[model samples]
Target: MNCESIRNQFSSYLDGELASEQSRRVERHLSDCQGCHAQWLELQQLDARLQGLAVPQDLESRIVAAVGAETDAEQQAQPAPPPRGYRKQVVAAVIGLAAMIGLLAVWLRPNMPPVDVPPPLAAVVVRSIGNVQVRAPDAEGWSDVDGPHHALPRGSRIKTPQRGGCEVETATDAQLRLDANTEMVVHGSSHMQVLRGQVWCQAAPQQPLTLGTRPPADTAAVPDVFVCPAASEMQVRVDQHQAAEVGTEPVRKAWQLPLLALPGSDQGELSSLVETLLANVGHSKMQFMNADQIRALGPRGAIPLLMYVREPSSSQQPAVRRQAMQLAAEVADDTALTMLDELLADPDPQIRRLAEATVERLSVGSAR
Candidate 1:
């Protein structure tokens, strides 16, 4: 990139707002261009100086008191009300003065604590399949939520019965798909906790999404997919995809998984790291290192790493098994179909259920 182009993006670069490619280019240019580098240093110094300056502790109160005194003096200096004929004008002026004083008092009120604002509604149910229900925060029981589209209130709990699923569109236009026999509580527009079952999500450009779950009892569990969208902030969580048994009845409803539109980037070194981590599966140190690297690698590093986690092993840690299920659901790759199929015959009921959900998710993702 030219010096002019690098200079134009200096502010964004300083704020870490530039894309990786652009940031790299700017850094390379700065290394070879002395003038631009000097300019960058000046900007950094100026920012540091500004941040170092502190506001006077009583500045607000002092300003308010000074303004109030000035207002009172001005009023006193003004000529007295002319006569009875000007009575209406005098009354209006008095009312205005009182209103001003009231406003000033409010503005100068001390020790007022900040109020917390709840996150705004970030998504709405855009589609629903068999036996989906919602329980509002104020409701005592689940109400059947039947339709093509509906607005889900914040703090509501949603459930999909056997053979059921649904899709939600987030404010950023990202899509989240829930698998059958799943339950989750919506925390905010961009955040939610998966109580049980799996969720498939695709983030909008520059709008990262987060899904939180309880920490696993087993230390070997696979961590959750903390999806950071293109040029966005990072969010992390642990994966816990354990399933619950409802009954002996067979699932009759069939729902397709939502199509995922992930960023197109080769895994490269990340894939190698994931392979090494899997080869050393039971080693805690290796697992920790792998988790750190995957997080640093971002969304592009999700797929095969998660696929490795999904592979079932009788000697594998419970935490690792659970993590694989959850990450599989998050990534939803078709390649996991064989492993998921094998899990169907596993003795553990919870693993079977988790595998079933993951299969559905992968099917949908693969279809797309």
Candidate 2:
């Protein structure tokens, strides 16, 4: 490949998200071209530098204070506080100073009223791991998740899946709906851990849900951990070590395309590492997944492409959607077919049409 072509795929190559053929071409060129190799080195350094940047501790505190202030202001705007006994009044007096301070903050702040959004509803991202992943429906049909399995932190939201399906929604109005017979976990606040089952979720805004920390337990038996960030609204599913013949590895790994879209050195290597982690999901889980089973485990194979169809994000361009549809059709299943059929009644005619066409191709393969 030429320099431009090689450069275009540099990100994918670094992320290990490239197709086998593309990976080979880039690897070959990098071997022969010192310039591109040097470019790779620079990219690596840049990633390291970026990753080292830490999120400020004050961020959480500031956000909490902001919310508290907003609440206090609303309370003061009212004539009377909730009724309480004499002892309660005494307690209120002690805390009244802090409330007054919060009230002042609310008056001074520019954002104005702060809505009391629920924690689970505040989830901004929902990720499914282990066994299977699916979504419920929105106005459209079932959406496809492409980009990256780990794309939540990137602000890419999953549109709500169809009704009656196991889907998860995020605070950003994104959704993660699982099809029937699929099993997975939804981590982050509104924390849900799916053990050999399918689930759907809706996230709240302000704090996008992501996989937070997991509750301590005998991980060797569970083999999967889902964490809810403290007030962050992000859900994450971590593969845990379960007692099984699949060795000490988790069943599989799947990432969103956006995570692979990260800029850095060895984007491919890092993706590969995540993939290896998913593939090596500890215990005997690995042995249970056949080739097809492995592919269905995450976005690594065809699942991401399938999930992207319903994604109503600016990032998912038309051409990208078309390409993803083609890929999904190649591995379409009955669940996908049913989901597409339901999507035909979607409010977005365009999405409905796309689902119709894609489902037809998928069903044809099923017939054969």
Best by TM-score: 1
Candidate 2: C-alpha lDDT: 0.44
TM-score, prediction 2:
0.21
TM-scores for the candidates: 0.35, 0.21
The predictions' CA RMSDs to the true structure, in order, are 21.5, 22.5
TM-score of 1: 0.35
> Which portions of model 1 show Cα errors greater than 4 Å?
1-119, 216-225, 228-368
- lDDT tens digits, residues 1-368, model 1? 77788889978866668887776577556545657766875665455434434445565455556655665676688865345545445445555565556556645887767544332354677777678898776679998886655666567788888787777776656666777777877754555667676565555664345454544556665423233343333322123434222211122112232212112222453444444455334233225655555455443344444445444432367666555445445544565576568768776677688778878776766788
The number of clashing residue pairs in each candidate reads 4, 95
lDDT score of residue 105 within candidate 1: 61
Query: Which residue segments of model 2 deviate by more than 4 Å?
Result: 1-230, 233-302, 345-350, 358-368
lDDT of candidates 1 onward, in order: 0.57, 0.44
